[model samples]
Target: MSSPEHKQKIWKMIKDIKVGMLVTLDNGVPRARPMHLVQDEYDGTLWFFTRRSAEKVFETAGDQDVCLSFSDQEEGVYVSLSGKADLTDDRELIEKYWNPFIAAWFHDGKDDPDVALLEIKVQMGEHWKAKESKTFQLYEIAKANVKKDATPNLGENEKFGG
Candidate 1:
């Protein structure tokens, strides 16, 4: 299980990523697609909006296990989350997460029956963060080389329940 502090850190890393690669299984083969993160909070779950007719819906029906990967290279943060995906047509939630930007895809707005929400019930997550500045990283590298030490601190590597 993740402590509240860990969850907060993970949330901060991913909240602004905006886009993530959602991976699902299709006929036992891995298929991935870029998905927009529609919600603001992390809290052990993630929300995404998608068309009901998308292939991922069928794929999830066959296999609930999925993975979401988020990265911000400039910030040196990356997160991989494993979860079960569920599709919902709850009108209230659809409206709650709705925005003008999504209208281009749904066309008919909140009332569109084809618009579906993907709720990922995250179960496990792993994250890597490089907390050092560029100069510090360079210094560490040089120190390691001079000391003939192969181990270098590259920040935190944590695994926790989502």
Candidate 2:
């Protein structure tokens, strides 16, 4: 079982880093590409816009298992999400998450025949977020290096599930 607070924290980090690498298995090899996360709410699911003819759609069709990796370097936050990706032609969802940025990709707009949605039902996730400033982190690392018996305090690492 997971706590609501953990879920909220994970969602907050994900929202903060809107773009993530979506990884899918292509012929038993991992293939990844940067994708924009469009969903506003985190309810054990994430959404992305793609074209029907996209290679990712075909890849997911073969193997639903996928991973989404997010990183906010300035904030020192990194997250990995494991889930199953499904491709859909849901017009309702397309319209709900539509924006001008997305319009640039879909030249024909939401009604474009190629418009498609990639939905990932997240099953588990892990995140590492720095609890201290970079300078402090460097100081801790230096201290640890000098004191071989000490362990460097870096950040919070948590794993949660839906």
Question: By lDDT, who's the top model here?
Answer: 2
- Runs of candidate 1 exceeding 4 Å displacement: 142-148
TM-scores for all predictions: 0.91, 0.94
| Clash totals for all candidate models | 0, 0
Model 1, span 24-126: residue lDDT tens: 9999999999999888776777899999999999999999999999999888899999999999998988888998778777878878778999999888989
Candidate 1, after superposition: displacement of residue 117 in Å? 0.3
Query: Candidate 2 — what's its lDDT?
Result: 0.90
Model 2 ranges with Cα > 4 A deviation: 1-3
In candidate 1, where is summed lDDT lowest over 10 consecutive residues?
1-10
Q: 1-162, model 2: which lDDT tens digit per residue?
A: 246676677789989789999999889999999999887878778899999999999999999999999999899999999999998888889889999889998888899889999999888889999999999899999999999999899999988775
